[model samples]
Target chain A: MKRYTVTIGDITHVVDLQPLNDAEHYRVWVDGQVYDVALSEAPDHEPQVHPHPSTEAIPSASPAAARDRPADTATEPADLRAPMPGVILEVNVEPGAEVQRGDQVLVLEAMKMKNAIRSPRSGIVAEVLVRPGQSVNYDEPLLRYRQG
Target chain B: MNLLDTLLAGLLSLSWGQVVMMGIGGLLIYLAIAKEYEPVLLLPIGAGAILANLPLSPLVGDDGLLTILYNAGVGNEMFPLLIFVGIGAMTDFGPLLEQPHMLLMGAAGQFGIFGTLFLALLLGFDINEAASIGIIGAIDGPTSIYVSNQLAPHLLGPIAVVAYSYMSLVPIIQPPIMRALVSRRQRLIRMPYSQRPVSRRTRILFPIIVTAVVGLLVPMAIPLIGMLMLGNLMKEAGVVERLVGASSNEIANAVTLFLGLAIGATMRAEAFLRPQTLLILLLGIFAFGLDTAAGLVFARLLRWVVRGPLNPLIGAAGISAFPMAARVVQRVAQEEDFENFLLMHAMGANTAGQIASVVAGGVVLALFAAR
Candidate 1:
């Protein structure tokens, strides 16, 4: 459960969010009143790791929506992300591997077809976020590149 | 002395044709086991052929096990229709719903069926037999079996084999035709994924509406479409989870074995080793090529009029090989531009082909079955 403190026009409320079956659906409690919500589209670049809401969260925004800003803002270029939901069949690159744009980085099996995922840009790999056989949701980060 | 005479009698009666048929059966079994080419059906088919082709085989006479299964299922066309129920339950028409315009490609993908039908007639096959061969153009195994059993029972074995063999070869067969027809500039065209929110109510109503509309338009289509829609209705309703599970898994698997075996039994040496069998095999390739070309040309025509960023390669997916054809579209597109994701669009077309092929099967039967 992710807890947040909210102030809407000077009225404060305590919110508790609990994830349900999938990443999109959640059970949210606002001042002890509960409601189930489902997002129509999953957030494109939701950070795999979350910082606690008490420290860095804003005052009033729907916390989930807040995480879903423009995709280009904080995400560095060449940090490979899954374009669709699939299981990673193989990950060819490790940390610090030098790669060129359009080189095969990994193979992802989705819809029973093996999709060879290629590097979007030429860069040095900083870290690999996922390993072979890991099932990933659409747009989940696969690996990150070293920032210049 | 009696037991020895009985054992020697079996060897004495075996002919070259039976031996050749058994060898073919063994080859099919080998392909199914080693290569894993549509093994679920092929393995059963190979086994059935071997069982039926043995000299004075118990499985070949009127009261035989293989014949009983063939008469009960394939003879009446029950197995193929049952298989369609499972197919309907498994198919997700969401991508087609998201992009309704892709239905044109589905319709165009069936061009080879009619084209092949005419070719078969010129090659001296009777109208009904030609029509049966044409259904293989869609690469839809169940429909081919359904139509062939009804129209040309003699050709059922070869037609079913060709349909299944080509369906497994989808990845290998489709790429070259797709790459050839679509130039590099057209191949690189990117289609961004659009996830339209299809409502629960809409999903529930889709199957009912399709069954009614299609049933009325072509009454002959009622059986295939009705079963297909029934399965889809169960899936979308989500209330009949048990029924959906049974149809897609238990019932389908059981019937696939029966159907493949029955179709295989029809490949008795006398019926299968004909010169016309070779012609049917050649026409199978012709039909697939024409179907792919027709789809590509149709999509290119649509692009000119609609002025959308449509990739012609998605047209190849209109062949109704289900998700396989759709995946090939994605594979080929990524070959030219790795970022291009034509999967959703191709799936839309592929699913449309699923329905269109059924409708085409009905149309073909309506035109030629009685006459």
Candidate 2:
């Protein structure tokens, strides 16, 4: 068994790893907590697991829950998310507004400094979810663009 | 009758010069309390100045508070080095490591130190004195005090004042120079921040490598650079959070109070009232302006050589003033084009300048120490 310390954010966890019978699996002890984890061949190649046909009959209305309902909702990738936590100082785009890639979508004020959040791709603004003076957290979707 | 006579004698002993010196102290206190100009140092220094010059005050006499503090640290170069530990603990070198080319701007920023040294030499100051005075261009308080105390102990008060005053005035002094050198078009150039994640291993190694390299090259700089890098290493190791907090906050604060008071006590009228003091003040400003201009000019030259969106304004951030220099660069760029965010790039250059300034200080010591 080999010990390694990993820090996630402000917390540090000391992990002890011991290889099992197979080369691909290991028994890990993290801060006295035990977990059995398997090493994957291709970590970046995410296997798409399709849902049951009966579950796909009615699509979930919430777009944010992509992990739970990945069939139809995950395909809509035009949502521009806030890159950092800040107050929305200004919303430069409105609903139905045409925008190009690299266009300034909104202004965010964090730590008394202003940052310009730009659009990811060219599309029509289908919805502006954030308003001026509204605070937003990191990775929170600020606006959605209509599919071409 | 004897008590009344003693009171009269004490009142009579107070000179016009002492009164003026006390007023200067009051002004410094007012600036610290009211204007908030470097309150940590200025407050103690101001109070020390008052105590040192008072009629028969025991604060600065033999074995007094101010005298003992001066002997304990400022005189022997302990305070500044201790303060360096705090500075290192507080500084994040991630930006500088991400972009190593910013090191050139840091080196270029030291032009003012040499330029001012030459000017001071011409103005009748000795080579040692001139070099100490020139280090005010470093835009670093502890480094300035450390170098000047060693080279020219008499000129410590004026040099420290000039270094800090200009450091606080970074926003005001640097903007005009930046605008003058880089046109609105160049300032508007958006250098997109490429997030090159620095590994934890690299962060841990950085301070160690820097210390060995700098120490081997310029042995005189070992004290300042070594302490600084030691603080940085502890911060990156992640095992010493309590030590880091204490070094950056508590120790730094305590040292600042003592260092400031000791430096202030040295400013008695006999030593401080010379015509050379005024000259040093002017030369100090001249050196700072030269450093800024040199950094801007060097950045413009780099833009010509490098094929990319380079904002020459960020070059001005290559002084040792830390985050302030970077912030000024960002503000200047934003004024011309709000969409342009040069803060990350400026920070890279700013941190690079911090290391470069220490190196320059070491180089200065080497040059003088050889003689």
Candidate 3:
């Protein structure tokens, strides 16, 4: 049993969870609140969780295969980030746009504040990953940049 | 009396005090528009002051629109709570969760709130009134309202104005204090950007857990924390997109308009012209300065233990201006090292400051109530 102190919305709950045979499945008791948790790896660190249906079976990964997978897959380089989690108000720099450090590359509107995301270093823009109005995470690469 | 004679008489009877207050009000308006200092509050406040100081404006009268708004929102404390809902919907606590220890910085930054509270008491302001005045140091509007409404409702207008005014001045007041507290080498420290993927379960559970813990600790904070968490839970739940959108946008906008206008209208010359108001304004600035100093000092202490680059300037982000304080930290960090990017770290501390300010506000109320 792994004891996890989970704090949600200002209330801290000491949770004890019995790990299942499958890496993704666990029986969690959070301060007496029971939750059956299933973990899934999302693309690009997007926090998307679909509650598992009661009838769905937990998929098990063998110990040998589990050992081969590397940890820390979610870390992204600093140059590629959303600046703030918000709707992309505009994307000014396109693929192959030669940009210098501090060049305004995109406008993000979060909590009614218009923030300009600038290029981290002088580079040739490799790809623009998001479009206008696309909601992005804090670490998701907004664009790729190659050395100019 | 003839119409011309009555009009001239009314113009001539305008009090010198009212004229001076009007001019002071106009200066505030000018600062808001021209200098762009806290435009959201100052613009409306300046307008309200001007209108009220006019020879015979109906706006301050019993039947006036301003009076009606004041009664509907500010006097009753509904608008600030509603605004908290919007603030809740808009806030992203992921940064704070990623760096749980940053909460210490937030706590340290709130020294201004209590520090100023003590100072106000020293100046002979009564316990309850001093508590209300000291909350302006929190640099948070809703918390200021929540505390002042309970302790000293009469001082609400000055406290709110000072709270917001000093919040905007964070960029100006904080940087120098930060510099003074930390050396050039400290500011140049580059924090590595590390992104830890937070689970949706954790996100959804955060507001609930925080509300429960804080509410249990300070029952008076139940309303404020409950409403804040309610909004956060709605946003994190992902199923309540429509409710989140409405709360964050429409409800927030409506509340801000009402809250801003009503808060402004409370600055009647008679109420706001006193020396106490001036002292409140001065103490408000001092409180913010002290808060920034405390955060920087705490960050320097943490640097001794924590590995990796911990930019001390990011500690200044502990003030509760949300992203603005974070951006200012980012800007200052960029000035020090062209390659250094501290935005994410600054944001983490800034988000922690948001929660810390609420907790600090609650703690203050709890302390005063206990007394």
lDDT of 3 by residue, B118-137 (tens): 99999989998888888887
Q: Which ten residues in a row have the lowest lDDT in candidate 2 chain B?
A: B334-343
- Model 3, residue B200: displacement in angstroms? 1.9
- DockQ winner between 1 and 3, please give it: 1
Lowest summed lDDT across 10 adjacent residues in model 1 chain A is found at A48-57
lDDT digits (tens) for residues B205-298 of candidate 2 = 9999999999999898999999999999999999999999999999999999999999888878888778998998899889889999999999
Q: Write the per-residue lDDT of candidate 1 for residues B1-371, one digit (tens) a residue.
A: 88997879888889899899889889889989998989999988988888888888888699988889988888898999999999999988988888888888899999999999999999999999999999999779999998988899889999998888888888888888888888766776666454677898988899999999999998888999999989999999999999999999999999999988887888888999999989999999899888989999898888877644677888898988888889989988877557566777888999999999999999998998889
For DockQ, the strongest prediction is 1
What's the chain B TM-score of candidate 3? 0.94
Interface RMSD of every candidate? Answer: 17.0, 17.6, 15.7
TM-score of 2: 0.76
Report per-prediction Cα RMSD to one decimal.
14.1, 16.8, 14.6
Q: Could you tell me how far off, in angstroms, the CA of residue B132 lies in candidate 3 after the best superposition?
A: 1.6
Best by lDDT: 1
Q: Model 2: residues >4 Å from true position, as ranges?
A: A1-148
Q: On a 0 to 100 scale, what is the lDDT of residue B2 in model 3?
A: 83
Candidate ranking under TM-score, highest first, comes to 1, 2, 3
Residues forming the 10-long window of minimal summed lDDT in candidate 1 chain B? B188-197
lDDT of 1 by residue, A41-122 (tens): 5446554322222112234255576445421222235467776667999999989999886778988887667888888667
